[model samples]
Target: MGMQTTPMIEMDFAVIKEDFSRYLIHDGAILKVKIVVKKILRTAELTAQGYPAGTSIDSVNAVAAIVPQALKREPSKEPWDPRRDVGEEVKFEPQEEKWQEYMTTEGYRILIKPVLTKVFRYNKYNDYGEPIYSAVIQSITNIEKLGTTATT
Candidate 1:
């Protein structure tokens, strides 16, 4: 039999949680943020996708492009030590845009377009000693924010 391909799927999601972390580096602070979102599957879409009725999914990580705002540098508080001197205080913020407006709200909505690809395993095997193959989300594209309530 020929190889079967997974169909492209698009889904709506609601941002449930957001976490941010900053790491001090020589140039500036590297800001990393993680966002958790839950799929908001509609009845019509679920039926179209051949999913059974009353199907539900748990929260999953959201992958999107995050453009940080302008970087600002400030004098170090403890300048006694040479390594501690220089640009020690860095402020990083998300840019004011449609995709980023969710950062200022308790909860927001988004649409995700994901591409799937097959992953080949070298050493991983199943209980039957057969090579395990799985479909993986390679990349997320065309992330759009929904609703006008988040704009204001």
Candidate 2:
């Protein structure tokens, strides 16, 4: 019997983008990036012309015509609930202890929070029977907001 050994695979990766400045900090070095979550998709669907049984094809056949279909989801309206505690959180910002100091005399606050932008809707469902959403905070921007802001 011969001893079998697995072959090593050499993997090389690169970040191809128009600009990579945001990823670098003061020292012109890449910032520490943490991958919080990783997901692997195992499900996929294929849409092609359905060829029924007893369908014959020529070896030198012509190019198959591809068709496109449009799919849309109906927007849901809020149910008539007079006493709804809270609807849903569209954006989340973390506050610091000195958040109060950022407030101006006219009750305007200028605090530094991550600029969140919704990437896309996730496929997961929540307890409220609604589709879970996800977002990404790429960079920080200055924003002057009026009125009191909730801190938690």
Predicted structure 2: lDDT: 0.26
For residue 96, give model 2's deviation from the true position in Å. Answer: 21
User: Judged by lDDT against the true structure, how good is candidate 1?
Assistant: 0.31
lDDT of each: 0.31, 0.26
The alpha-carbon lDDT assigned to residue 44 of candidate 2 equals 25
Residue range 62-114, candidate 1, lDDT tens digits: 33222223332232233233233232232233322122212213122433323
Using Cα atoms with residue i matched to residue i, what is each candidate's TM-score against the true structure?
0.22, 0.21
Candidate No. with top TM-score:
1
How many steric clashes between backbone atoms does each model show? 0, 0
Clashes of 2: 0
**Segments in model 2 whose C-alpha atoms lie over 4 Å from true places:** 1-110, 141-152
